[model samples]
Target: MTDISTTSRRNFMKLAATAGGGLVLAFSWTNTLASAVMEVLDDTNLASGKIDFNSYLSISPDDVITIFSPNPELGQNIKTSFPMIVAEELDADWTKVKVVQAPLDTNKFERQVTGGSGAVPHSWERLRKAGATARQMLLEAAAKRWKVSADTLTTENGVVVHKASGRKLTYGELATEASKVPVPTDVKLKDTKDFKLIGKAIRNVDNYEMITGKPLYGLDVYRDGMLYAVIQRPKAFGMKLKSVDAAAAKAIPGVVDVVTFKNNVAVVGTSTWQVNKARKALKIDYEAEAPLESSSDHDRIFKELLSSKEATVRRKDGDVEAAFKKAAKVVTAEYQCPFLSHSPMEPMNFFADVRPDGVELIGPIQTPERARADVAKLLNIAPEKVTLELTRLGGGFGRRLYGDYVLEAAELSSIVKKPIKLVWTREDDMTGGTYRPAVRYRFEAALDAKGNMIGYKLRGAGINSGNPTREDNFPSGAVENLLIDSIEHQSPITTGAWRAPITNFLAFAEQAFLDEVAQAAKKDPVQFRLELLDKAKNAPVGAIKYDIDRMKGVINLAAEKAGWGKKEGVSQGFSVYFSHRSYVAQVADVVMKEGKPAVDRIHAAVDCGIVVNLSGAYQQVRGGVIDGLGHAIYSNLTFKDGAAEQSNFNNYRLIRMKEVPEVDVYFVNNGIDPTGLGEPALPPTGGAVANAIYKATGKRLRNQPFINQPELKTV
Candidate 1:
């Protein structure tokens, strides 16, 4: 874990307060309302004192800018990409802006959580408006000095320029005057075509810091007089901690204290290595629950879900059953996807300093606001007393959302009555992770006599990693007649969100099955999709959640770029999906290498509205595609008796450099609002690759980790 003493929490807070000039500029009406809402929300405890936006930014007299990002950046380029949003709008010199993790104070900073690929898109408007407003005020100050109308002065490179008088002033020169100016209520924003820095390719702002080995990650945080903690959780789900003999652990060098919490015993020591060593030295005994003692028992739950009659209907279209009866042929296929782990390169770690006044938490957590509430509730303290500090994550992949490790660290600090750091070894991280729920989907499609698609029915059972009922506001009512049903297989093992929005894997299964139906009809997959899109666009079957035109645009782009219908030698497959308000379509080119399927290239087309930071957007699309390939081909979390079966990378494989395909990403040229890129590219990759594999071998591999299935092997 990071040494917080060297980078004292108090010192970091002080620097945050004075890092930016105290000039609150209002650039647009939307910003004015958002700023007011933020201030009101910050002052008033909402959602049980969650973290809010005010905690992140502070301007100083010197005009320096400091932004406290609450989201843990796990190698997703968030540290650079998110900051770019602020710099672009704030009109601050990208070079001069300093980024730091926000201290967790649920009462002061609400909603500091970052997940669901929302960091850039959600904050885009707010951060930009904040910057633009601030710039306008500074320009006003410069205009006053030059005896020129504010309209005559403009900002460039953090300087106010008066063209007529040739007068110039740095933001620093007008900091005091700008601070006193009335925050503008109506600020004009640049059009998409006029964007100077937003659409341009820029290197990560924190790239230098990372390359130089600066203390940017959660594991690098440290504190004075802090102890290190390690917890030993149950080896199997549903297993209870029977007993533990700490004599060996206590006798270990540098071991300070040993204590048992709710489910596990923690070993505390002077250093992380010491605590880890002591944890291993300690002899632990667990009473395994019978249901969790075997892998078959866990598999039984999935089997039960597959056959269970009690299923909640997620979406329903026209008479699917009647449509099936009227069809000339009905093709039915069942696809299965296994549970997965986020397994970010950086293991889970957090530092907590529990003092009488308040609790301080530092970690790579996705939701700082959630962390604040959890810590406060667990510690029986006021939410204001708990402060969460977000740090750079090695990688999130939807793993950091749990905040369980953060809670463990706070518990340790409270027990030890001193500052402490909790570090999870790779084994601890992998085993204790909140896994992506294993899911099974059954798809049936019917075609008319003319080989024209008629009706589609999909039924599936999976653990609703999110609110499966679609009752949650974000994904609530996203699709219609979709018939996404789920059963919560209650297990002691934790589960949470993954890369794409909920049901992404299911969508892949559904869309890929649609491709199969197209093949059964001997119709072009792209044309079949366009036909469905036309129906969904003009007379949508039900809810019509997606933007049909945007979806069609991406498919057309991918098909055109991949030389659809004309490409030869390599088998081609296509899939498209929408999530986080972004639309994406992908085509995979595959070839058999040594009797093994190898993806040679992927043609990806996306319409995320407007591109903010084109290079970063491209990187995210490419990264997400690679991520999808890794998950589909290599990643799986199996269980035996309720415990995760894979322990480390040695057993649980990941896609390597050699397997990475040449990715061609093209953005649809349309002046539209910006959406998220982090996850949109991931959902379609599985189906696209699956489609290509089918073309290569004339076989449909519906199961995930496709390499493991015997059916995937060619004759």
Candidate 2:
């Protein structure tokens, strides 16, 4: 299957060259024309003859060069950052570079994903090579023309120059000659210090398209004869459709067809509004499952798991029992976090045109490769028969990872035998979401007389919706000398990734508890953490997943910037966490406003390896602060009778413009490779806010949605 996708992409690249140069010059690190060309050349079985450079680069006689990218852009600023890599090495004008989404062809494109905040870091090395390879090829061609050594020809801004000969040629003029040269396997990439565009503050290429409301998103995609669709999923988790009276739905104006599938009903119409109207008009009967009995039942299951004697210990260090026995002061606390919704601005939607021969799918999807395979499996068609088109996502936040909505659209289109667009209304999207699993964490810390940490034991239990396997790649205990155990409290509700900081959510509770331990010892919070990190770094407890030095770097930077121990009137709190391969620490300053905890300012420091686009990196950190603020102080998803209690914004509140506080971000100046910013900033925010709340009220708020305490007065 993988081989077939690779072949298809190579064929597409060949077709792209012969099809009147309809190539879209998009720069990408993951998937691009250069990557496709390289794949065919590298494959021993696939390369039949000398690899042609013309397959990857298309230069018009008019001096225009177009590069094709296979990866989709979903507002994480890859459109700009990825191109910077290409332009930097190709010596092309940044202003002249244009980006377009690459079509799905497994054979030609590499890494057709836009998640895990890995776009820049993963593509950095490869993209530089692609650009340099192309540049070198063009230089070789120019050197031949000028009758000079290749070393004498230096490429500058896509122009090859021979200083002694005073000869120059644009890459476009030498493109044909370069096409015959074999790709160099050992091309040198530019050093970080020599980079002109990589570290610079460049705006997102799609910023104008987004701000002006251009048709860049999947919702904006239109076809000549496309029909709109709305599905009626089960009202509650684990419910099954017993019957659906679609007679009235079909009677609605512009309603084309009504169909029933596995667990939902679909209403197809001429317009989205008409389909929505028809969907609502239809009456659905669902067989309520046992999980829908009550929300308390689910809570009880989680509690039972937490208390269960049997568990898999993720990490265990040095006779915790003996250490606890010798401790002077023992601290134990339990923290609980509720289920969360991804709630992307753009609700899930997909457009699919399924025919007997093939299927054409278009929409906002995060995992294009996964979507292609899933659609093919559902349609029972060869993977090649399925083509997934990616449009700019309004907001992904991991919701688009699950291509169920895409499969639904394909199924509807196949049944109707026409092109159909399936749109989930706000209600449907909210209720039918894959929620962040609710979790309960239990922590026990044994401290010596001087408030020195002796032993730490942590246990976590949650509805395994987000992660079912106790030993998944992530969330598994990467900490040492710690007993990290997880138990699944199975629930019928769907679950998926909600940014980063999944297990780190427990870190907020753990780090806050550490602060409490410090207080019990009359020690400073920052000092305590640094001491613990020192211990974790050298004599480490169980596993050594976190780079203690990197964590300390961020922590110390944030502490120094926030004046960790000097502030008098204002109270200070701090939290440091490492996740998604990025390390972040935040120091929050809180002051009581109208007798409630009001954050005045938050100082953050991050070490996310390398800074790809400084502006985009800063935006992610800033946005993460806001996102964390909302989750800590306000966000919660409550359920009653297995149905979400909060339907929309009115019931489920989000941090508004007025609620945003001043956030100052400081990036550690280590030019390490870049890590994720999208989620690393999130985990620390919740803990920082919790720590701030403690400073204001002198009370530890272990539970999330901290504002809901009845004893606390509202502003």
Score each candidate by Cα lDDT: 0.73, 0.74
Worst 10 residues of 1 by lDDT: 471-480
What TM-score do all the candidates reach, one by one? 0.90, 0.91
Ten-residue segment with the worst summed lDDT in candidate 2?
Answer: 468-477
The sequence of per-residue lDDT tens digits that candidate 1 reaches over residues 221-243 is: 87768888889998887788888
Q: Which stretches of candidate 1 lie over 4 Å from their true place?
A: 1-63, 68-70, 89-91, 107-110, 293-295, 298-303, 463-484
Candidate 2 per-residue C-alpha lDDT over 94-185 given as tens digits, one digit per residue, 9 for 90 to 100: 66666655677676456778778776666666677767777877787777777778988887776788889788887666766765566666
| TM-score of model 1 (CA atoms) | 0.90
Report the Cα lDDT for candidate 2: 0.74
Global local distance difference test of model 1: 0.73
Maximum-TM-score candidate: 2
